[model samples]
Target: MVDADQTFVIVGGGLAGAKAAETLRAEGFRGRVILISDERDHPYERPPLSKGYLLGAADRDSALVHEAAWYAAHDIELHLGQTVDALDTAGRTVRLGDDGTLVHYDKLLLATGAEPRRLDVPGTGLAGVHHLRRFAHAERLKGVLAALGRDNGHLLIAGAGWIGLEVAAAGRHYGAEVTVVEPAPTPLHGVLGPELGNVFAELHREHGVRFQFGAKLTEIVGQDGLVLAARTEDGEEHPAHAVLAAIGAAPRTALAEAAGLELAPREQGGGIAVDASLRTSDPHVFAAGDVAAFPHPLFGVRLRVEHWANALNGGPAAARAMLGQEVVHDRVPYFFSDQYDLGMEYSGWAPPGAYDQVVIRGDAGKREFIAFWMKDGRVLAGMNVNVWDVTPAIQDLIRGGATVDPDALSDPRVPLDALVP
Candidate 1:
């Protein structure tokens, strides 16, 4: 149980940390809640950084978790631009950055999120080479994107993951020539599989975005410390006024590892390991957001979700666990993406090679479809593309452990509820 007098310290003032603070107040914990972030800005949502914010459709204030006054109004201490230098779990203290101020805590939540996986290739350190992770990165990339529009320049994007693809869309929207290079046979094939991945490939190709698949970037060539072009392993050169590396991210786990916290197995991507309740090896410490690798009850597998939904839901779940509530972070993993006119919502867990077959409802040619992944006739996961008002039904089918017929699942006329069991 939590004591009203004790202080609760939350590290990594991103969505997860901010939501944890909100949960504490909503759950009626009158303790001193202190949230810390290395970034100078207050906690903010990251989704917009790649879409609206980068395109000038939204502003920094629009992405913030709360306005500057909300923290004070809610009595939550906001520590921005300050890194937690050390975590002394036995001493129950966290050392602050530079100033070396030690903040004592009765309980701690490690919401330390992930950082972009750096590119080690040559010229990655160039001025025009960028990675999208923080608001600062977005701000710089936004300027380059605007410049690309004015100059009618080319933008070379490394990796065809969600961030890379989203940025490619934004770049094309700004009238820049966009070229995406992915090492896979099909973009996003590792996750969405080849069939669906080809859908995205077609979407981009229709919009005149070029693709270089089955090839890796050998070098990022630069002139005067600015990106000029990128060379592929096959020796093809692609011109670029700017380069964006969207390779993916690695969970920030130095603090947890240094403090002797257990980590998930190597096969699980090596994140801070936690139980269903989000508690770390030490009962006094907890982990959430992208940093946490917890056992997912639905699939009976460990997953480290890096999407916004996980952070939004995991925050409150971890908080309830901290308060001695019987909490299970068993929510079906969900994620959505918007690229050009295509918007998609996916629900449930489908570990690689886990689903035996896929059933498609709606027309893939029209870029409107719901693809269902099944195992032993039971729906394990589903994704709706350009489809509306069916997320709840899709989720129900997944959570209800219902066996759905392929013909019915592929037919739009059949009500999703009727397909249940």
Candidate 2:
């Protein structure tokens, strides 16, 4: 029922953009589909970059979203190593960065994603300094870790966030000495709070990873264009053959900003502001993945999720919306992580101060427990550590928005489904 002359354009080459393109084709859209990416490689999932791939357990090809031949077979105009420099919202066109080629689009999806926040301290440009955001960064870090392992070198990590902690585990697995410098009192204090964050601290500490808590890296000392050590605010100098700045990532919103798109404020986890259907201020444009901040009907707050699950699911939702489907992107926020022997899956959003009292079910010492963040006797978020197959039940409890006794919630004997109204 659609015009074959119409075209749908996607601006990113990451998982979200790739999945959007796939969804457009799957939704029976026969119009011209143009997918542009700045990276030369095919779109790939990023979880393995810091997980299996960095640990040398998964191969590079395992990360690809689809086979190289799939794009051509599906008749997708795959433009790799291409950047969109200018977005002409008035003209419904985008200008290519390399050759200034202008491409028209009936509808545009902005999945520009995010970039790692660089460490601003001096000596960051020295050799052996690293930031793991892209495939190439992971490749280089893998080599650096291997060399450090063989040569007995030290690795100084700047933050205690997920990336820093995961890379710390990988470095230890490689037999390299690892030290993490964190500005918070405990690792992941912002996300898990100090209570649960201590669990991760102990996990890493058991594996020989040292933590310098409540300190920031003021300088990265180097000599002869190579890293030598990192000096923190506490005046402690840590010897380092390599340094990783795993502080965080900022959304890539330059293209959207230049196009006069509405952006969420800095406090709302800043990104391109989109509605429940992922439609931007301009009706002809939409957004998804890390670059899109949309209001969540469930959480009742505007959220910009940087996790893999958001990208994996948001892309297709935006695609369907673009194709005139009635879509509401209100899926509960979800993410997972693996470090050393501990693995965890978290659902819903319950940052510190948002919920009161965290109730734990099972034994924390054994690392097999489900922690629930509750407010007014209702579950706001749930994280199952070393627990299996209860994500559905946990999510149901959150979605049902029912209040239950804290004693029953903390009792393993009680079934999670029964708690949901």
Tell me, by lDDT, which candidate is best: 2
Give candidate 2 regions above 4 Å deviation.
none
Error of 2 at 120 (Å): 1.5
Q: 103, model 1: CA deviation in Å?
A: 0.9
- Candidate 1 per-residue lDDT, tens place, 1-421, comes to 4677999999998999999999999999988999999999999999999989998899889999889999999999999999998999999999998799999998899999999998878888899889999999999999899899889999999999889999999999889999999999888776787768899999999998999999899899888898889999999999998999999899999999999989988688678999999999999999999999999877888999999999999998988888889999988889898999999998987755988898899999998999998899999999999999899999999998867789989999999988775
- TM-score of each prediction: 0.98, 0.99
Question: How much does candidate 2 score in TM-score?
Answer: 0.99
Residue-level lDDT of model 2, residues 1-421, one tens digit each, is 4578899999999999999999998989999999999999999999999999999999999999999999999999999999999999999999999999999999999999999999999998998899998999999999999999999999999999999999999999999999999999999888898779999999999999999999999999999999999999879999999999999999999999989999999899999999999999999999999999999998899999999999999999999999999999998899999999999999999988899889999999889999999999999999999999999999999998989799999999999988889
Minimum summed lDDT over a 10-residue window in model 1 is located at 187-196
lDDT of 2: 0.95
Task: Quote the lDDT for 359 in model 2.
Answer: 95
The lDDT values for all models are: 0.91, 0.95
